[model samples]
Target: MKTESSAELTLRGTKTESRVELTLRGLVLGVVLTVVFTAANVYFGLKAGLTFSTSIPAVVISMAMLRWLGNTSAQENNIVQTVASTAGTLSSIIFVLPGFIMIGWWSGFPYWQSVAICATGGILGVMYSIPLRRALVTDSDLPYPEGTACAEVIKVGSGDVADKDSVESSGKGLKAVLVGSLVSALFLVMVQARLFLGDVAHSFRL
Candidate 1:
C-alpha cells in the first residue's frame, strides 16, 4: 500500500483538522496520562536511578483509549502521547534537582525557581535543536527505532477494515499485541520473584 505524505494528505483533505487534533477529550486524556507517567517516572528515577522512555507506552495507551472512546482519530492519539511523553521527560528534572537540596544547596525546592530553570532549559534546547531537525530527521537515513515503532502502532490501529481480509489482518495484529503484552508481563513477574535470572552474566559468572 502506498503511504500518503503530509503534503499529499493535506491536499486530499485526509489529514486531521486542527479542531479534531485539539479536542477537549484528547487534552483531558493527555493530562491524565501525563500525571500518571510523570509520577511513575519520578518514583522509578528516585529508587532505581533510572527511568525508561514513556513515548511507546504513552502512544499505545493513547491509541487504546481513543479507540475505545469511538469517534477519535490517530492524530488525536498522537497529540495525547505528545503531551504525556513531554511530562514524562520533564519528570527527569526531579532526578537531579533534589540532589541540590540533599547537598544543602537549598532547604527545599523553590517553586518559581524550579519552573524558571526548567522552562528556560527546555526553550533553549528546542531552539538549538530546531536547526538540526532537517539534517537529523529528513536528510539522514537514521532508523528512529522508537518513532518507527510508534508509527507502526498508529498505522495498525488506524487501518481501515472495509474488507474481510483487512478485518482479519487487524484481528491478527491485535492478538499479537495482546500476546506480546502477556509475555512481557510474565517475564517481569518472574524477574521480580527471582524465579528467572535478570542477568545471565551474573548468574553464570561469565
Candidate 2:
C-alpha cells in the first residue's frame, strides 16, 4: 500500500557520473584499436588461420594510453576495450566470406549478398546470445576464464585491487608488462625470420 505516483519518485542525492567517463579521447583510442585489430586479425586469420584475442590487449593498451589523461576513468577505458573487442568477437563473417571464394561457391565478391548475409548472421547472433548468456553464464557456474582475467586486469589498472599497496604494485605491474612485451616482440621477430616456428601440428594414426 506504499505505491507512490511518478511525480513523487526521486533519486534525490545520487551522485552523477563524471563527464570524462566517455570522453573524445576514449572514443579515439577505441577507433584506433578497432581498425588496427580488425585489419590485423583479418589478414592473419586468412594467412595463418590464427587470430589473437583482443579483449585483454585492448584493456591493457587503453589503460596505458589513458594514464597520460588525468581526467580518464575506469568506465572510459571499459568503453574503449568493449569497442575494440567487437572487432575480434563480432567479425565472424570473415570466416565464411573467404570460405565462399575458396570453396568455389562464389567466383568473386558479391557485395550485396555478402552484406545481407553478414547483417543477418550478426543480428541472429545477438538475439541468440541474450538467452544463451543467461543460461550458460547467469544461471550456470561455467568458468569464463578470459572474462575473469580481463576483470582482474581492469581492477589492477584501476587500483581497485588494493588501497595501501596500489602504488607499489602498479610499478611492479608495469615492469612485468614491459618485460612480457619485449620478450613477445623478440620471439615474434625470430619466428618471422624463420628462426623458430610459431606452431607445430602433428598427426598419427591411432
Which candidate number would show the highest lDDT if scored against the true structure? 2
lDDT tens per residue, model 2, 1-206: 23322211211111225535677888899989988788878877877777778878887777766775665565676778777987785565677787888988999888999989977886897899898765665556556677666656665666555634644554455567679869978999999999999899899999
Task: State each candidate's clash count.
Answer: 0, 0
RMSD of 1: 6.4
Q: Which pairs clash in model 2?
A: none
Candidate 1 lDDT over residue span 1-206, tens digit each: 33443422322332344326788988898889888778878877887788878776776666666665677666776778778877767888976788888899989889999989889877987797789766676556666767666665555555432334533554565467679769967988999999998665435555
lDDT of each: 0.68, 0.70
TM-score for each candidate, following the candidate numbering: 0.65, 0.65
